[model samples]
Every structure is written in structure tokens, then in C-alpha cells.
Target: MSQELGITVKKDQNPSEWYTQVVQKAEMADYAPVKGCMIIKPYGMKIWESIKEDFNTKIENTGAENAYFPLFIPESYLEKEEDIVEGFDPEVAWVTHGGDKELEERLAVRPTSESIIAPYMADEVRSHRDLPLRLNQWANVVRWEATDTRPFLRTREFLWQEGHTAHATEEGADEETMLRLEQYQEVIEDHLAIPSILGYKPEHDKFPGAKYTTTIETLMPDGKSIQSGTSHQLGQHFAEAFEIEFEDEDSETQTAWTTSWGLSTRTIGALIMAHGDDDGLRLPPRVAPTQVVVVPIYQEDNRDEVVEYAEEVTEELEEKGLRVDLDDRDHRTPGYKFNEWELKGVPLRVEIGPNEVEDNAVTPVRRDNGEKKMGQDREEFVEEAEEVLENIQESLYNELEEYLQENIREAESKNEILATIGKNRGYVKTRWCGKESCEEEIKDEVSAEIVVLPFEEDSKPATIQEKEDHIDGECAVCGEKAERWAYFAKNY
Candidate 1:
């Protein structure tokens, strides 16, 4: 492959440039006309669609239905919830004029749909019979962040699915929040093949106005963390603000407990960083848009025979329920097709040359590690292709899981925390005092903040700190009594 067609920079040596080259060269996404924005191409959207389909199934199974909400939110609605509005103040984009006339009330683009969705839930929920109001929407939101823009990772406008639900009790809200968070873990780790640290954010750093926020943070190869997904237990905050009062069986009116969770297109960015190499992207087969691409190698003389045999192989894989692509483009050489498919990160490639066409067999190559299986009987190869795809998916995930496990190191002192994460650039598990001042000390010194306060095994976020069994050791930063188990890291 030429310099322009293939990745020109090594992934570790120049991660930023390597990412840009792969994103555009492999047809994932392109920079939009506006800075801080990107147009996700068909290839990139394919990955998001896979994420959506998987999560949608899990959500719908729990009685949540998909719904649509407006993009423009009235300023009055946002003001109803002071914490949420204040939380997004700097990034909120407002509209003062409508077409030609000046509007009486300003319109704020939806940084998130909590303000709008809460009111809608208020209208639909009236009594205990209408409890557990669950709704979600797949849409785009705008936040006018002026700096540090990148495609998918931190775009000004991006696509996501936000889930909003109302319940009669805090217990119901807790169950709902943990439920969605687990589903997000499945979507990220089980399907996307990216492992992450699961925990709740520190109180000072939880989502604004939320009772608590559960999150999944994944480490990138470049030593930055990705806030991949979040689930928030809203606990009567939005319900009180939006007047979502439902009547109980005893005829008492009460505010509903609410919860919200979201997973965004940024997962596409995570996929690129977690698995790509100097050659190009290396997709896990579970969510790869095209699992297998069969390239027919032939000359002008034997084109028909070779191409026909390749089609048979493609049909066999398709019959076995694989997303197979037959590269029968007459103009492009077999080598060119191989490079292009490899750049696109197709997990498995079958090179059907003249020799294999004559042998009534196929030669298979693994994209993850470039391993080859030569001269396997055609029927046997087709029968075993599904197993190969499964193994590739598992192998890719295990590689990342091991990397994440190896990098999570424990630290006891403030200097140790700074030196370890500053040089190593992964997670530092330490005891925190739960004070913003102590957190700021580290943030000011080396830019690593408390990313998570994890819950112990078989523990609940709401009651984890209240448990008496866990000990409160000295804080790593101030040497005061520690209050939480925290993971500190630099993030994107």
C-alpha cells in the first residue's frame, strides 16, 4: 500500500495522526464543514448501529419503549431544574431569534433531554397505575464546546440514545439505574470487546443534580480514559422540578423517582483506539460490519473460473449466517482488494487465488494477528468459518482485558499516585478523603482527577459507603481519614 492509502505513522509513535489517517482513509468518518463536528460515514454508522441494536434489545426487554423528543428546549423548562441548567451553562447554545422575529423566550439546544423528557413523563404519569414510566430516544444533541474537538470522541453535535424513566420508589429507581448500567457493560465489554472499570463517580464529581451516577471508564492505548457510558439515579430531583406528582393507592400525591442513562457515538472512537494497529483497524467479529470478505485472484484468461469459485464460497458463508462480501471488482487487483479490506478491519479474509480454485479448497487469513490456514478443503473451511469468527472475537477481547488488568496499579502516597499515573498513564487505585480540595491537589499537580469511587463486590452504590465492614484508611492525598475507594486518571 502507498503512503496515502495506508497508515503512514506508527500507532504508538504518533497516535493522534494515526487515528486521523485511519478514520478518513478507511471510510469511518470525515471532518464536517464546521469545526468541532464530524459527518459519520456509512462505515462508522455501521458500528453505531450494531451498538444500538444490541442495547435496544436489552432495554426493550425491561419494558422501556423507544420514543422521540424535540431538539429545541425552552429556556423556561431548563430553569425549572437549576442543577441541570447550571451544570451545562458554559456549553449551552441558545437561540434568541426564530427565522425573522425575536422570540420572547430563548431556546436552548438540548445538551441533554432531561428537562424536556421529565415534563412529558409528568403528563403521561398520573397515578400508581402509570408508575414506572420508561421512554428512550435515539437522537442528536448539541453542546457548543469551543476546544479540544475530535470526531466522535468530543464532537459538538453527536448521536446517542438517552433513556428516561420514572418510578414510585427509590428502590425502583436504584434497580432501574443498576439494570441499565449492567446492560451498558454488556454492550461495551461483551459486544464491543472493550473492558472497563465499573464504579460510581465521587459525590463531588457525579452528574449534576443526580442522586448518584454509575459509570464505565475504559483506558485508551494513548494513556487517556474514555467515559464510555453512564447511568444516573435521579431520585425525585427532576420529578420535583417538573411537577411529575403521581397519586398513590391511599390518595396521597408524591413526586416520582427518576433515572436517566446514555451511551453515545463515542464508542466508535473507543473501538478505533482500542484495536487499531499500524496497518489499520482490527475489528472484533461480533460487531464487524463485514465479518468476511472473499477476494478472487485471477488473470484475464481464467477470470470467470476463479470469480465463480469465489462466489460459491461467499454463498456458503452467507448460508451459514455470516456477513460476507465478495470482491468481484474487475478493475481492482486482488492485492489491492486485500489491502483495502484489511484497512477496513474485516476480521477474516479468504484469498481465493488460482491455486486454491484448482484445489477445491480455500486459504483463510486472520486479520487480528495475520495468521494463515492454507489449503483447507472448501466444505470444511466453510463449516469452520463461524468458529474462526467466534475465536477472533474472544481473542480480541481477551487481549484488551489483559491490558486493562495489567495497568491498574495500587498507590498509597500522594507522590506515588502522581509519579505512577504520570509516567504509566493508567489507573491508580487509592484511598480518597471525598474532599474536593484533596482531589484538586492532585488535579492541579498532574491533571489526574478522581474518575471513580468503586463499589465493593455484591454492593450497592446508595449504601456502599454506609456499610460498617469496609475500613476507612488514611487518605492518599492529605493523610486524613479516607472515605472512598477511588481510581484516578487523565481522561479524554
Candidate 2:
């Protein structure tokens, strides 16, 4: 493909520019007139819907019910949770008037629905029976950011699902938090085909008003980490602020313990950065909008036969439950069609020609690593396509796994940590004292922060105490006894 028609920058040389060109060239999104927002095109929206559908099923199965909250939150409501208000003050977009008239109480466009949803949950939950009340909303939130704009990565308004739940005990809330985090891990690994590190966010970086935050972080090709998803243990903080109390079994009034978690459109950004290349996006089979495209190669003399056979093959693949597209536009050359599908990052492509029609076979090409296979008979081709799609999914994930394994290195001291990060863009594993001061010191050196305190393998159920346990060695920066071995990376 030529520079004018396809992405001109290499993925490694200039990921930022390459990403912008790929997203636009592939028709996933377009820049909006608004400075910090983007318009999600049909292809991008399809991928997002696929993500939503998979995650919604997981959330519902966990006993959470979907609900909606108002987009505009009253100013006073934010004050109820002082930390939340302070944390979002800069990004909170205010709606000051109705048409031309000044409003009595200025409203803040929802940066997040916590303040609004917490009070509603307080009103609905009354007794122990309502103690574990769980509610979630699939909606858009506006956070007026002042950073450099990227399409799905960071925007003024983005789509996401915010889940809020109230429980009778800290144990219940803790369970709720980890459960959601695990579900996010499953989605990222199983569906999106991206490997991630799951653990706790350091104290200074925990979500505002949260007792602690748990996160699923994935490393992008740029040597930066993107927090793919996060689950927070609010621990009665919001419940106390909003008075979300319930009567216990003994009939005594008590405040509820609460937790909130979210997976956003940012995950789409992670997918693109993790697997996209100089050609364009390399979508996983599960989330790819058009997983397979059938292109027919024909001339006027054999166009009828070639086109007819291609349609038949398309029907056969469709019946097998694949997202198949038949690219039979009469004017486009086979080479052009191939480039278009590749640029769009379809996982598999099938080529049908007059020769293949006479031979009752079809050839398939894999996108993850351009490995083409010889033609197979029509009935056998269906099974081969299924296997190739599965292999592509596995291959993509394995490639990421290998990249992570090769990139994550142990650093013995603070200087080592700084040197390693400066030299390579990946995770640097090192011991830390678990102090915010020490973390800041390291950040000053390499601009990398503690991304996660990785979960340990043990027979006991994963808990905060276990996640916080120190792994080995002295603090990399402080020279004090280490609290834990943390994964540190410069984040996106």
C-alpha cells in the first residue's frame, strides 16, 4: 500500500502518528469539531458493542441489575463526598444556565455517576434484605480533560459502564470488588486476547475516596501502561457520606459498605495500541466486527461463476456462526480488496477464484502473522477457517505473553530501575517500601510509577492482605525493608 492510501509511519518508530492514521484509514473514528472529543464511526461502534455485550452478560450473572442515573448532577451532591468533589473539580464540566437564564444551582456534567448514584442507592436500600443491592449503568460520562487528545484513549465524553453496589459487611464489599476485577481480567484475556497484570494501585494513586483500588493494567507497545479496568473498595466512605444505611438482622441501623468498578472505551484504545501495526488494527476474532472477508477474483468471462461460488462460500461460513463479509464489488481489484481487509484488521480472509471454483476449494490467509495456507475442499475449508480463527486468537495472545515475559525484568536498586526503564519501555519489577514518598522519588528519576502489586499464588483466597505482602529484598529506593515487589511502568 502507498503512503497516501495507507499508514505511512511505522508502529515502533512513531506509534502516536501511526495509530492516528490507522484509526482514520480503517474508518474506526474521526476527529470531532470539539477539541477533546471524537466521533466513533460504525466500525468502532461495532467493536465497542461487542465488548459491551460480553461484559454485560458477566455483570448480570453476578447479580447486578442494569439501571440509569441522571447525566447532570447537582453541585451540592458532589460536596456530599468531599474527596470526590476535590478530585474531579478541575475536570467537572458545569452547566450554569438553562438556555439564556442563570440556574439557581449550577449543575456539573457527570464526570462520573458516583455522587448521583450513591444517594439514589441510599434511598432504595433500607434493610438487610437490601444490603447487597447492586446497580449498574451503561452510559456516557463527560470529564473535561486538558491533556493532548487521542480518540478512544482519552476524550471529553466516553462510553462506559459504572457499577455501584452496597453490601452489609466489608467482606461482602471486598468480594464484590475482586469479582468485578476478575471479570475484567477474563474479558481482557479471553475475549480481547490481551494479557494483563492484575493487582493493587499504590496508596497515592488509589481512586478518590476509595479505601483502596484494584486494577487490571496492560502494557502498550509504546512502553507505557494503560489501566484497562479498575475496581474500588469504597468501604462505607460513600455510604456514610450519602447515608446509605440498612437495618441489620438484629434490627439495629448500620451503614452499608460500598464498591464501584468500571471498564471503559479506554479498553478499545488498549486493544488498538497492543495489537495494531503499520498496516492497521489486528482485531481478535471475538471482537472483530467482520472476522472473515471473502473476496472473489474474476474477469467478465468467469465473473458469474466466481461470484456465485463466493456467495455460496459466504453462506456456508455464515451458517457456521462467523461474522463474514463478501467483498464482491465489481470495480475493485483483488489486490485492492486484500489491502482494504488487511488495513481493517480482519482476522481471516478467504479468496475464491474461477480456478478454485473448478477445484471445489478455497484459500485462507491469517492476519496475526501473514501465513497463507494452500486451498482446501469446500466442506473442509469451513472447519479449517474455524481453526485458523482460533489459532489467530491464540497466536495474538501468545505474542503478547512473550513480549511481556521478555520485557519484565527485575531491578536490584533504584538506579537499576531508572536505567532499565530509560533503556527499554516495559515493566520493571522492583521492591518498594509501599510509601508514597519513595514512589515519588522513583517517578522523578524515570517518570515511571508503581502500576501494580501483583497477586501472589497461594491456597488462600486473594485478599488485600495477601496482595500487600512483600515479596523479597530491600526497598529499591528507600533502602528500608521492602513491603512488596511492584510492577512499575511509565503510563499512558
In model 2, how many backbone clashes occur?
1
Model 2 alpha-carbon drift over 4 Å, by segment: 459-469
User: For residues 1-492, what per-residue lDDT tens digits would candidate 2 score against the true structure?
Assistant: 556567888999999899898889999899999898999999999999999999999999989999999999999999999999889999999999999999999899999888999999889998999868999999999999998879988889999999999999999999999999999999999999999988888888888999889999998888899999999999889999999999999999999999999999999999999999888889999999999999999999999999999999999999999999999998788998898888899999889887789999998888889877667787887866777788899999999988988889999888889899999969999888889988888888878999988776453235566666545668988898888878889997
TM-score of each: 0.98, 0.98
Model 1, range 266-385, lDDT digits (tens) per residue?
999999999999889999998999999999888999999999999999999999999999999988877778889899999999989889988998999999999998988899999989
Q: Which whole-number lDDT from 0 to 100 does residue 120 have in model 1?
A: 94
Alpha-carbon shift of residue 374 in model 2 (angstroms): 3.1
lDDT accuracy of residue 267 in candidate 1: 90
